[model samples]
Target: MSFLDKMFASIGIGAAKVDTILANDRLVAGDEVNGRIVIQGGKIDQDVDDIYLKVMTSYEQEIDDKKVHKECVVGKFRLTERFTIKAKEKREVPFSFELPIDTPISYGKTRVWVETGLDIKNAIDPSDRDYIEVHPSPLMSKVFNAVTDLGFRLREVECEAAPFHARRRLPFVQEFEFVPTKGEFRGRLDELEIIFLETNRNYLELLIQVDRKARSIGGLLSEMLNLDETNLRLTITNDNAHNIKDMLYQVIKKYS
Candidate 1:
């Protein structure tokens, strides 16, 4: 190769490009995502050291008392080992990975996407980003329906930096916020916040926080300090999906 050709490829001019095609972009949490990576060679041959995929999302973090969104990887996987593409070559590699069960749903400002990248020595790495729509798992879907059934409206949803006690495999947690509009707890509780802690084919685990309405000056002060919030960890199984509304009502009522 000529020196000019190498220099141009190193700067990503006439360098190999990559694109990812997903079989289905709309899927529920825990589902297997199938896709293929397409690499198209440019004017010169290139040796790729490796191929990688990252499941990415953003979360709100308070830096200097200012809330800003930052990117975080939920999962990463490898597609292939070192490979060489000849000039003007076209290559396709199939790949599949299980979506992390705790992946934040594409609700509110939360977005999830797959990032495919090619690692090249002494050359700019080319990457492709494809956004996907993730839905709640079956049992988790039931939980949301139950909350709405109880006359609660989804007010806001966001993925926030996880507290030390709540951190799992991920540094952040997706929180679903709800407000009582026409229920018994409407006058008693201020709001409800829920986080999906874990999920499996058989069950869904959740951390629920109940914010009660302040009744006095002391209560108001406690609320401001986040002391009046009650946290509960509940697990709903496939068997409980049918009675989720009553089960949720009973549990939340105890706290509200």
Candidate 2:
């Protein structure tokens, strides 16, 4: 290789480029993701040490009393071992992986993407990012429908820092917030916050926080101190999806 060509490749000029194309961008959590990595050789041959795919998303956390956004990887997959791409050559590698059950859904400010990168020794790595739409799983859909049917409107959805004890495999948890607009709990409760603690093909575990409205002076004082919120865990299986509305109603009613 010419000295100039080597210098250019080192800075990513005329270097191999990578692009990942998914079979379908719209997917549900716990589903399989199929895709292929396409690499186009540039002006010179290069040795690719490895190829990787990472499922990434971002969450907000309070740092020094200020909200900061940071990225996190949900999963990672290796596609290929050491390989060489000749000048002006093109290559495609197939890949498939199970989308994590706890992958954050594409809702509100949350976004999920797949990052493809090629590792080249002594050369700048070429990378590509493709965003995907992640929908709720079957059991999660049931719970969301139940809440909407009860006249609770979705207020906001966000991924936030999770306390150490409450965290699972991730450092943060996705939270779904709702407010009663015209239901029996409208005046009794201020809001309802739901967190999917654990999910699988068979069942889902949720952490529900019920915030009650202040009634008496003592109640107002407790609310002012952020002590009027009740936290509870609920587990629902496929068989219980049909009655999820009633199941959730009773729990909220008890606290409201």
Candidate 3:
């Protein structure tokens, strides 16, 4: 290759590029993701130091009272170490990943994607992004459905910075917001927020934030002081998942 050619490749103008093709874009949490990454070589052979695939999602963060959206990596997979692709060569790498139980589901404004990159020595890395939809886990679906069964409608689902009280492995936590459409608790409660902290084969640890509707001057004062919001930690097990409606009702009742 000529000097100019080498310069162009080094700058990634004519360098090897990576593209990730997921077998399916829609998946449920706790399910397996299968995909193939295609690497296309340019005018000259390219030495790849490594290849990395990252699973990430977007979340909102508050900075100086201003909300900004940001991407958070949920998982990462390394595909290769010290590989080379000859001139005009094409290579495909197959992969499988088990989506974690706490993977954020596609709800409201939340979005997730897989990013593949070719790590080239002294060269700009070429990358590709493929978006995917993640649905609720069986356990999550059960609890969320119970809310609807209790006359509550799903209002919004979003990921935000985790509060200190809520221990989380990830920097951000997914919260499902709901409003009672018709029920005894309808007028008394303003909103209900549910955050799943962690889950296992036998149990699910969750955090709940209840916001009550202010009915008097004292209540309004408490609301402005952040006292009207109550946070609770609840652990539900496979044996008692059916009682989610009752459990949530009791919590709201207390705050109402």
Task: For model 2, state the Cα shift of residue 245 in Å.
Answer: 0.4
- Candidate 1 displacement at residue 13 in angstroms: 0.7
Task: Give the top-scoring candidate (TM-score).
Answer: 2
Per-residue lDDT, model 3, residue 30, is: 68
Which scores better on lDDT, 1 or 2?
2
Lowest lDDT sum, 10 consecutive residues, model 3, at: 162-171
Tens-digit lDDT track for model 3 on 176-224? Answer: 9999898787888888888888875567887888889899999999999
**Ranking 2 against 3 by lDDT, winner:** 2
> How many clashing residue pairs appear in each of the predictions shown?
0, 0, 0
Q: Which has the higher TM-score value, candidate number 1 or candidate number 2?
A: 2
lDDT of 1 by residue, 1-256 (tens): 7888889999999999999999999988789999899999987899999999999999998999999899999999998989898879999999999998878899988999999999999999999999999988778888999999898999999999988887999999999999999969888889999898988878888899999989899989988999989999988899878988998899899988
Using lDDT as the measure, which candidate wins? 2
For candidate 2, write residues 99-161 as lDDT tens digits: 988899999999999999999999999999999999998889999999998889999999999
Stretches of candidate 2 off by over 4 Å are none
